[model samples]
Target: MWSQLTKKSVWFIGILFLSLNAYAGHHGMKKDIVDVAAGNENFSTLVAAVKAAGLVDTLKGDGPFTVFAPTNDAFAKLPEGTVEMLLKPENKDKLVAILTYHVVAGKVMAADVVKLSQAETVQGGTAMIKVMDGRVMIDNATVTGTDIKASNGVIHVIDTVLMPK
Candidate 1:
């Protein structure tokens, strides 16, 4: 009887551990696009720009948005003072336009992205999509990473910041 009780207790503990792990995994995957971006160090510039442009709430909303997120290095590649200028309150409109240019209306996965020649942006400009030398390009920015799942959408990392013409 003692051995049987011990086995039962062990089984119960094992099930509880598994259950807790599963819940954690699910919770981890539930972060929205903005939250995911903010959690990553590489997206610091992008996150700050979004906050400066007052786009944090919009990006955090229930959007199935596909974001071509540029890294801090990408922002650094811009002409000197460009990011600083855009972050100014007076340039909010331009900043919003530029940021929205990187986002699409829906959760478009990498597989679907490669099939498109161009995608219409939330900024009302169209971004030309091309696959050259086996690398995907959205406008002039090359997609370095793809299909980072968020609760509301997906993120694709880009090596350059996209500008609307």
Candidate 2:
């Protein structure tokens, strides 16, 4: 019964995704990093956190930035209550640090990402990179999608949310 409900939910979500695309704000043309995430249902959790952290305007601003955005499912993988705790007003600084850790100063496409071994994040930490079986891994998270262009920068989807030291 549980499995059946889960399957039905997945099917509903798939249909919703298709409908969402028709009204997506990010579309084929110009959209900033914030817009790109906001327009994508997969990144809804990320968008909420960005807004909560007060980094929405910074990400929406001009100049290239590369963001390895973790999907909603990725956020869900964190310890229970972790997301709720991070969303608290008192945890703003900590949340900002974690979010910034996912961003790089310049736009790095998938092609360029593969050639490098590591890259520094905006949070003043380095993200370790490794390639195994022709797949790029950042820290322990694999890059799922790359070079999702935005007016201000680019976004690459990752399977895990990176934590900053």
Candidate 3:
């Protein structure tokens, strides 16, 4: 009777431990940059562009990337048919270039971003960073939101879709 009681107690403890670990792991897991963006309705256009450009995997991959993400409204601000043109199959290269232009190769939070004059983009172009009238600007876009944490990196919301020169 003692042996059977001990075995059952041990099994119950083991199951409880495993269950707790699983719960903690699931809740503690932070979503990656792509997942963060995909989960937000404000980034729908940006997410669609990332998917259309075949960049979902690269953005979701490991390693910190700083993305100055434009919202759907920003995409709407573009000339009529511009976003549609960019999403076309034949314009994949252009779309990729444009998308990558928004990403820097490392995780740069808002504090660090304000100190920089320029950042080299993943697309190999330099983005001009400036602070004017107490607001941060990345190229012509205004940094409306900052320090959005993600598993892979960080995202700073911008008011315009940055175009690579």
Model 2: how far is 97 from its true place, Å? 0.4
In angstroms, how far off is 29's CA in candidate 2? 6.7
Q: Quick one: ranking by lDDT, best first?
A: 1, 3, 2
lDDT of 2 by residue, 1-165 (tens): 999999999999999997788657546447899998999999999999999999998998876899999999999999999999999999999999999999999989999999889999999999998899988999989999999999888999999999986
Worst 10 residues of 1 by lDDT: 24-33
Clash count list over all predictions: 0, 0, 0
The C-alpha stretches of model 3 lying farther than 4 A from their native spots are 1-28
Candidate 1 at 3: error in angstroms? 21
Task: Compose the digit string of candidate 3's lDDT tens values, residues 58-130.
Answer: 9988868999999999999999999999999999999999999999998999999999999999999999999
* Candidate 1 Cα RMSD (Å): 3.6
> Native-vs-model 3 lDDT?
0.95
Q: Check candidate 2 and list the clashing pairs.
A: none
* Better by lDDT, candidate 3 or 1: 1
lDDT agreement of model 1 with the native: 0.96
Q: Highest TM-score among the candidates is held by which one?
A: 3
lDDT of 3 at 163: 97
Instruction: Give the Cα lDDT of each candidate.
Output: 0.96, 0.93, 0.95
Error of 2 at 45 (Å): 0.4
